[model samples]
Target: MHKSQEKIPFWRVKKLNQMNSEEWESLCDGCGKCCLEKLEDLNTEKISYTNIGCELLDVDKCRCKNYAKRDHYVPDCVRLSSANISSLKWMPSTCAYKLLSEGKNLPNWHPLVSGNTDSVHEAGMSIRGRAIAADDAGDYEDHIVQWPK
Candidate 1:
């Protein structure tokens, strides 16, 4: 924790919009939990996270299969914007977007802070092997995963 060992830049000390591209991209913890399909109840407006993930999500790495054309493949796929981060409700509790928007610092396990992208999976913050691709799971109702964590 000494000043000499602190590699995090001052930009990381700023808010989400104040960060440069490198800092911004590093904020994504690569948990892949956000990539999972969520269904919202029309009446209650509550969202339910299914075990189903997008076809592009890599089951092992918990990253996108197609990062560039994801918007084309899934038209509704939200490209995180400065405007949207604060209101994104379904983002995992450990998500960087939710954290920054709430005026909190990134957790120690975050890839950006830890300097290792795989730290997410190591800390069990990533969905990883738990996610089943939507292509494999036909019925969503049957695949609802109520994660106790």
Candidate 2:
């Protein structure tokens, strides 16, 4: 009889704060929703996602054009980490960080669970090919969308 190997699920076993740098980084599902511009209502404190992507976002690849220097280019860009996870209320509900922080499991489309990097795009979760570049976008209010929710 052939021996069967047990697979260990890292996310289930490890707390978000316990993850190493690589593991923490890998938790990102590459959905690119975080790269989209958001508008906050001053009165209601509600955040709305816009289809107009950040200047550094590569819409097709759903990756940043300059990952290393993103903060330098976009001073307001919020860096997501375990410590600041709770403050990311504007992040997409489908975002892996938000899910994990809420003690929920990763979606099937997440690369860590799907074992394929393109699974997020295949699941129609990524902003790829759908978002307009911030430079080309006219009005933020006009570009508001409900998909990122």
Candidate 3:
């Protein structure tokens, strides 16, 4: 096809705020890193990630068991939206929302690009087997990890 006739993806042509609900939702790569517990040092204010998954996170699937009602279970749960995308500094660097907001392209292993839901896991990006359920995690400090950052 000619360059003029070539079709562009909605993500490439539309800003985050301009996307419809389906288009916006499709950007999530489902890494589950966002569901992991985090800590911020009082002195440096630097954020640290932990292997401890939220109580509602289904570690194996890298998704929340009660995504629709997560706020009821975990009050502090952050719901990412186009308006709040830029302010969520704790969001993983590999997050599609974060990447696109910063004018970057999605990685090859992203499901949207790979056309496979398991691509994130295959690329070792999802928290599938790495995260320990919060109920079983003894201490958040002890579970501190660097990969999610």
Candidate 4:
């Protein structure tokens, strides 16, 4: 197809809020770092990532077990939306939503760019096989890791 006739990707053509539900959902790279529990320093407001996966996260698949009902199961779960994306200071640097909202393009490992969902895992960006279930994790402090940042 001619360059003018080629269809641009939705993410390139529309803002986050203008995307449909499916388009918005597809932007997630499925790295699972977002599902990991985090700790915050009250005095300095520093955020620390942990290898402990949320109760609703499927550690192996790196996806939520019940995404539609995650809010119901985890009352404290922070839902990422166009409205709140800017204020989420703790969101991982590799997060697609964060990147796009910051006027950056998606990384090559992003599923949308790679055309393969496993690319994120293959790039060693996903928490698959690395995260422990929340129930099995003894202490959040002990699981603190720097990779997610």
Residue 92 miss distance in model 1 (angstroms):
1.1
TM-score on alpha carbons, each prediction = 0.88, 0.92, 0.94, 0.95
**What is candidate 4's TM-score against the reference?**
0.95
Evaluation by TM-score, superior candidate among 2 and 3? 3
> Each candidate's lDDT (Cα)?
0.80, 0.90, 0.92, 0.93
Best by TM-score: 4
lDDT by residue (6-105, candidate 1, tens digit) is 7766535677788778777877889888888888889999888888887788877788988989999889888997789778877777888787788778
Candidate 4: tens digits of C-alpha lDDT, residues 24-84: 9999999999889999999999988999999999999999999998889999999999999
Pairs with backbone N, CA or C atoms under 3 Å apart (clashes), candidate 1: 56-65
What would the C-alpha RMSD of candidate 3 be, to one decimal place? Answer: 1.3
Candidate 1 — which residues are off by over 4 angstroms? Answer: 1-8
lDDT (tens digit, per residue) of candidate 2 on 1-149? 33455666788889899999889889999999999999999999999999988989988888999999999999999998889987978888999889989999998889988899999999899998789888899878998899987
lDDT of 2 at 64: 93
Summed backbone clashes in each candidate are 1, 0, 0, 0
**Quality of model 1 by C-alpha lDDT:** 0.80
Per-residue CA lDDT of model 3 for 25-115, tens digit only, reads 8999999999999989999999999999888888888999998888998999998998899999989899999999999999999999999
